[model samples]
Target: MTLRSEFGREGNVWLMPGGSLLSAALAAALVVVGWDVVQLASEEALARAAKEIGPTGRLVLIADTQGRLPDPRAALAGRPRPFVVAVGAGGAFSTLADVVERRVAAAVLDADRPFADLVAALDSLLRSTPVAHDANRLVARLRQREDEARRFFGLTPREQHVLGALIAGRSAAEIAVANQVSMPTVRSHIRAVLTKLGVSSQLAAVALAHRSCREPTLLERMREVHQL
Candidate 1:
């Protein structure tokens, strides 16, 4: 028999025997577990948001860091709300525009001069860009796809509810209000969903919820039932 086929993730390779039922079952189980992890990651993102918004009172840190970060959580840290994107390498890292939708707590400009002056200037241009609203139109369109989630996704009811709220563009605070859970708990659930989906970034998770946006956010289609 040929050796098990190989699949790799995060630098580790998994070899599973193709013809064995046991191997297939294990593989499927692993996939589900992996998705579960993605969901956890999403909730963690919300926690990161809360921390950023919270006080130690808050400070906008400056340095050559936090861009192209592999983990979204690490990407955001200590750099206060209104980001000051200064000149950097070749590209302008417009981190400041991140939460423009919400009023920025504050902005701090870099006083030190840099070689990449042009790049820093680009950040100024980006900061001026208007904030966009969190539109629920996509959630409305994604309702039909819920069944596929139920049938193929095997997500727990709690997972579905948390995901549904996210698709509707509700913040973790909003979800906490609706679900009666503390904001931190809601954030945890969000992280779980991201981990399960194997995605980073809230927008990506929302896009997945749109799932070929021909459907609706699960709750919209579920009707008469409410979920956190």
Candidate 2:
């Protein structure tokens, strides 16, 4: 399921990878138990989204061990990471020995287990104490800021993408290559982005965009990854 699907459900946020039967089943189970499930396209997207959630927000990171999971330490670094749960065939859980040793993951189950057993494990993990704010509220606030920034600055989607590339420290040539556009075109987009954001230079634009989004920092990351 995409992020836009069934938003604002009254429960924890279940971040899952897209296109997996396990993910689909787990998402359904979590939804039945009042979790707002968000299926992202990749591990990077999942990690980035997870960072936006607050301490109080119950976040369950569900990953299949097809080898796309990020280093739990790096992905969960510098923030209060969610409870990670990995399930897959074979010795999938063994690969995450370090993660489990560090107590970063709540549980790692075998995919061969019955769906009911997996759900039961999730239920047990869900009993952990919750903190302060809701993940939905955080997500909504982030969306509001992004909408406000776009509205106030009159930034088009393409302009937002250009701005994101600039924020990532990508040069005009790099942006052109990434976006498959001409150097002149990339420069033109940069100029438009800077003008719309009311910034004098690329550096200023990046700083302004960061300030405009403020907390979460996920917005900036998302812009760079998903092009907003």
Evaluated with TM-score, which candidate comes out highest?
2
Task: In candidate 2, list every pair of residues with a backbone clash.
Answer: 56-132
TM-score of every candidate: 0.29, 0.45
Tens digits of per-residue lDDT, candidate 2, 100-169, equal 5545554545443446877777766666563433434444543444453553247667777777667677
For residues 1-228, write the lDDT of model 1, one tens digit per residue: 112323333111121112233223333433332211111123244344444334322212222333321122343455533222221111112332232212331332322223244224333433344344332332232233333333316455687787777776778898899989897888788787777766687788777644422123353532223232
Q: lDDT for model 2, on a 0 to 1 scale?
A: 0.58
TM-score of 1: 0.29
Candidate 2 to truth, TM: 0.45
In candidate 2 the C-alpha lDDT for residue 214 amounts to 27
lDDT of the candidates, in the order given: 0.39, 0.58
